[model samples]
Target: MTEETRNRALIVRGRYDLTVPERALIERGLLLADSLGKKEYACPILNARFVLMPAGTFMMGSPENEPDRCVDETLHQVTISKPFYMQTTEVTQGQWKKVMGGNPSCFKGDDNLPVEQVSWDDVQDFIERLNRQEGTVKYRLPTEAEWEYACRAGSTTAYCFGDDSGGLGEYAWYGDNSEDVTHPVGQKKPNAWGLYDMHGNVWEWVNDRYEDYSSGSVTDPESSSKGSDRVIRGGGWRYYAWSCRSAVRYNGPPDVRVNVLGFRLLSLSSHREIKSEVVTNEQVTSEKLKITSEKLKKLIRLGEEKGFITYDDLNDMLPSDVVSSDQIDDIIMFFIKKNIDIIDPDERETLIVNKPTTGETSRDRDFIAYNNGTVLDTRTNLMWAGEDNKFGINWADAESYCKNYRGGGYSDWRMPTLDELEELYKSENYENVIQITGWFVWASETRGSDAASFYFYDGSRDWYHQSNDSNGRALPVRSAK
Candidate 1:
């Protein structure tokens, strides 16, 4: 009698044998999903179920003939060489509350419903805290290719059920049946691989910046490049069936939170126990060296307390400057080779740099230079351009210059931010610092109609006219991940 009741009645009593298109969809969908059926894993930290996805190569993006396909979804081949575990469903209200200690979902009262209204930035905090609780850096957001690879569950069809949109109701809760609000997760039938809510429920966030797909094949590709917006896949409860297609993509500002956006977790290889090795003290210490040793001890203690350093590898990790040396210097350099892949870029950018030390500072050491013509700042785990651009350029040109940089065996580089430039000031007075003396550097920050620039002379910062009127050098930086 009522509209809502009518929709529910139709859903329950609907009966139709497989159509020609439906049979094709089912066959294709089963290709990927039929094998990875419910390799279930429950995270001890959040107690949510995860499914192990296999490693294989597949076509990524969409074909030109795909109906409603966007121009950016250029078909290409992608190989996911490593297997990872992905959450069977989007993160639910209960899991978010357990890891983040709060539930921000607009659709409340159901603990099993997918959590929404969480921004990509907020998800970073959730991931960091979850890693700490689990005592391993294994959890992360899936890459765009990984997300699509799993969503397809092996099939290349538009909706993962083939090209037919009529049968989408059986596998997803989209606009037609969602009743304008999210329902509980896993209520509908799953895809061929037993993955529920892949087509609908909410827009799932992937760990990639918005970029057009390339035509060439790639192996274990990653998007380390920085951008203003991040990619979100899958459709939401309020979206039409076309938007729920497996190849569909959307992007939003990383800090923007909406009622329809949420994320799932991707678990990397299991944790390994770090083995400690004994190292004999190779450095001969004088009275002055003793004082430097005290400073090093204090720094190490602070690092341990801050959860940045583990005690297991204390001996294995020593100051980089102390390598192959018979004597030590005023500055001590501790090397921490983290699993860069597991760290999120947003969180990496937020890591606090230690203040300059009066007696012996960590910033006094030279960065680890790569054969590819880039330098690594072990202190903050950021890679920087070994040299500045010879000619000063406008802000717009500076951005383009950084993006086009091809040094260091990497392609994902961008101009440093204002705060990041300020952090570079800590390296002042160090002999090995990049020779940008007497020149101002352009930062990726805008002040009104003008851009911000940092003067290397006195470490002063100021705003200047737009790129047309003002000129400065651009120094590119990339995440070590």
Candidate 2:
């Protein structure tokens, strides 16, 4: 084949190789064409934690007339370039421990408490350790500009909430709510975009060199090219609520460690260009089937006669015929059915035997249960029990929890809607299971209106019930494959 034709084939298949014919170009051993075409690449794994900040221009500082406005807090017009992710809250003791091997917070109650008394140098050490642990060198302290940009979250107000300090209790634990000490991070309200403790938790160390703002808009600004002290921002627990303004600034030596000091880390992400090829079944030839239809039919017949197909027989017969290029889907479906018989039958039979006797058995055995522990006619993989359970969560919260759940060999669990829940009820004795005390509270798919719930005690469908009053418990749970 011609070198050009071979190159074209390789390019179409998205494969990179060093082998190429010499006939296409090497005249007198001098290279003529660029044979190494660029191939698309992708990140097989990407994990970077970030908080989404909204986009807007805000007054960069507090007014001069405002109480406790430091000279640095000069009112100015600062236009945030765009929306971006910031740290969700100040770095917590738990997170610090993960990197530093010790907790430094004065008020160490929960691991979620904001880490304090850590110097800028100590924070850098923690960042280095984190980078090493994660096997990447992208992690570092956020530059001072990046810190202010994220803390502000596109808001120009003194606090992301507003100018009024009276409402500080809702968003932050300052001098009043702090009780002269730092509280756990994220206990108070979040900013507009759900970030917590961006204002008053502790002073956060940033990576910028301390310097005054320069004129004009800066894109991806960094700290001074050189400086002795690093920039610090955000107010501490002992400070007044207004001191926590988004535009506020402070600086400290890298070695200075105090009760109010802490730091957050940032990591630069590498972007990759991915080229994905869509291969249709039609494109695959019959010879590449891996398993032929005739073979599958023979196997199925043998299974029916002998009650099972031996692995030896399956291995001896090349699968190439059992799966045809055109019949790929059918072969896959057949194998799926066989696998289900091997894996799901026993569990299904157990569920069927345990099912309350009053319910009529449907011939279709493919149904699975939803979050309420009630059987759903459709396939789902969630398990649930009622209130006496630990983790109290509403439907939305429960749904979020279930989606993240990695249990029972299944990851596609979800909260069922009211209709889906009702379908599981034993219609004949709905009240029995629906109102069953201490068993399970049915999760309703309904929203904006009162949520519907069922009790497992009597197995009945009920509506307009208050989740708080029913004594029906919501069991935060996941699904089983």
Query: How do all models score by TM-score?
Result: 0.51, 0.45
319-383: candidate 2 lDDT, tens digit per residue: 54322222332222233223211113235455434533222222235443322123333344434
Candidate 1 residue lDDT tens string, 1-481: 2244324323322111222222232223212122223356687646787877778889988888988888888889999876778888889987775544346789989889899999998898778655533434468999999999989999988978899999999988889989999989888887777688999989998899998776899987777686779999999999999999998989999999899899899886321111112234343335444443454565455554553433223334343333322111101111121111111234433443632222221243646664234667776778886666544466766776676554433558788988888777776542274656326888888978798888876778988776442347767788888
lDDT of 1 at 6: 29
- Candidate 1 ranges beyond 4 A from true positions: 1-38, 270-481
Name the 10 consecutive residues with the lowest summed lDDT in model 1: 326-335
The lDDT per prediction is 0.67, 0.51
Report the error of model 2 at residue 379, Å: 56
> How many collisions per candidate?
5, 34
lDDT of 2 at 295: 53
Model 1 residue 444 CA deviation in Å = 46
